[model samples]
Target: MKMKPLGRTGVMVSDLCLGTMTFGTQTSETGGHRQMDMALAAGINFVDAAEMYPVNPISKETVGRTEEILGNWNASNAARRGDYVLATKHSGAGFSHARDGAPISGQTIPQAIEGSLRRLQTDYIDLYQFHWPNRGSYMFRQNWDYDPSGGDRDEVVANMQECLEALQAQVEKGNIRAFGLSNESAWGTAQWVRLADETGAPRVASVQNEYSMLCRHFDTDMAELSAHEDVGLLAFSPLAAGFLTGKYQGGSVPEGSRMSLVPEMGGRKSDRVFDAVAAYLEIADKHGLDPVHMALSWCRSRPFMTSAIFGATDEAQLQRILDGKDLELSQDVLKEINLAHRAHPMPY
Candidate 1:
């Protein structure tokens, strides 16, 4: 696997990042350990987790289980933890499970980091991210009626300055190496950058957002920010939560699948979703490609993409997705994908 620079953080991460949200939920500790070994063996040096994980049924009970699983692996294989770039997030807004839906503040930063460190059984996190902006975000299918009228700009910036200073203190304390943002907008990311730059704190290293063939919202403004500012994209749901994987192609949800657990696939199961999936699947077939491979490779092929965060419930699924790491898309296939995007834009 190839490595990419994580912004200006001086940390090189594998292009393919193993996402651990499924751990301790549909996947057990033993299963998660096996997946970790497989991912490491496959040269995936980056692992992504969150404080509120095991998210198929994200509950207070199973909240930090994913990080605990990674911590256990790190504890046992103490020597190998240093080889992987581990990234996790602080849940913000609407997640009553994490700090009772607390907006991320300077006060919450240390508490959240300490909780994550204990759960992961590690002293330092490679990349720590704000799961979403405290004010709010339009990433999760909220772009249709998205508005940023919640908080005053000065108040938001002051809050961010405080948070960034706290993060910088954590960096100085060697608790977290770098910082990132997720489910954030271009303007939101710019504010983070501006605050970090002005305050002499750590700049945002990456932004983990929903980016795939179906979701191209980041292609315009955020893409420009990423390219110029060196803030890479850690794209989550590059497969659109398996909608692009072609498993739910004909509206038949497979047993023991994520969709079976969360029937709506987190608001992705709309009437137009299958049409969009079919379009991509057809492009894959026309190009003599597996849809899953095509989907992952497409995400990896994007210029702004540093790592594609993917999760698997089983080793077989992990292997299938990993097989596409080296598969580069041809121009004709990309053209067809673009044409399909024009035909069925925003399927979900």
Candidate 2:
């Protein structure tokens, strides 16, 4: 439960951030409250949510319920609201439910922030992120045919400038303190950084991407940029959507789990994913370690990682992850993991 600086913001955040994507859907409001209480009591001071959360079903009705649940907690525990760092995102285009599928622009920035602040019951958001690049991203199983060539460079730069200016206005108005990115590539992040620098607006503070033992795309170019530019990574799905937790082994989809709720598991479900997960689970077992611990602790050990974002349906699952906050992977274990990655890289 140790704290780390979030980029160069002068703000300290817990190494383990409580992810609330399941707050109002798979997990009830009571269960969500219990999870938050346990995480805070156990010294976790960071919580991440989104405007389009409770995402197993991801319906319009339930889109912002997760933030609302957190907002209710903040309102009920006003004295403790300042004790934690609250982060949420503004959903980009393609979801007809959010802003009628409008791409993130100057108009949508204020519109999204107002709703998020209202639902979160907070005046200032600790971190406000673009859910994904409006142009598109290679994330969520889109890497195969991903192409940014179709986008207009002039239009994209114009949008970034306008959006960054709008975000700066929000900062001036005390609605949001920081800006970040999600599901972005190195090129996409670079454009944001360049625009921010040229405009004297807020530099991108962090990038929340899917980084797990099964996913290593961020290890190369993104790692280098983060190291030099101070845009730390808020790694989401450190467990690879519970695949690294060892619960989904043997092709068994446990009832009430994420896989059970969304069989495709947001495109992480594939024929090759299980074998990749098994290899890591074997390495964890060989080292007499819990797979969850090996997965989470390994993320913390990374040089440019600010925090590992993980969600839990209940307190037991949350405790299982928290117990490994201090566990460190031995060099031998790390070597084995790397060897396994080489054997079956990009399983999903």
* lDDT by candidate, in order shown: 0.91, 0.91
TM-score against truth, every candidate: 0.98, 0.98
> Taking the tens digit of each residue's C-alpha lDDT, what string does model 2 give over 1-348?
678888878899998999999999999999999998999988999999999998888997898999999999989998898999999999978988898999999999999999999998888899999999989999888888887789788998899999999999999999999999999989889989998888799889999999998888899999999988898899999999999987888889999999898888888887688888888888988888989999999888899899999999888899998888888888999899889999988988
- Candidate 2: the clashing residue pairs are none
Q: For model 1, how does the per-residue alpha-carbon lDDT over 213-287 read when each residue is reduced to its tens digit?
A: 988888999999999999999999988988888888776889888899999777778878888888888898888
* Runs with alpha carbons beyond 4 Å of true place in candidate 1: none
| Model 1: pairs clashing at backbone N, Cα or C within 3 Å | none
Q: Report residue 344 deviation for candidate 2 (angstroms).
A: 1.2
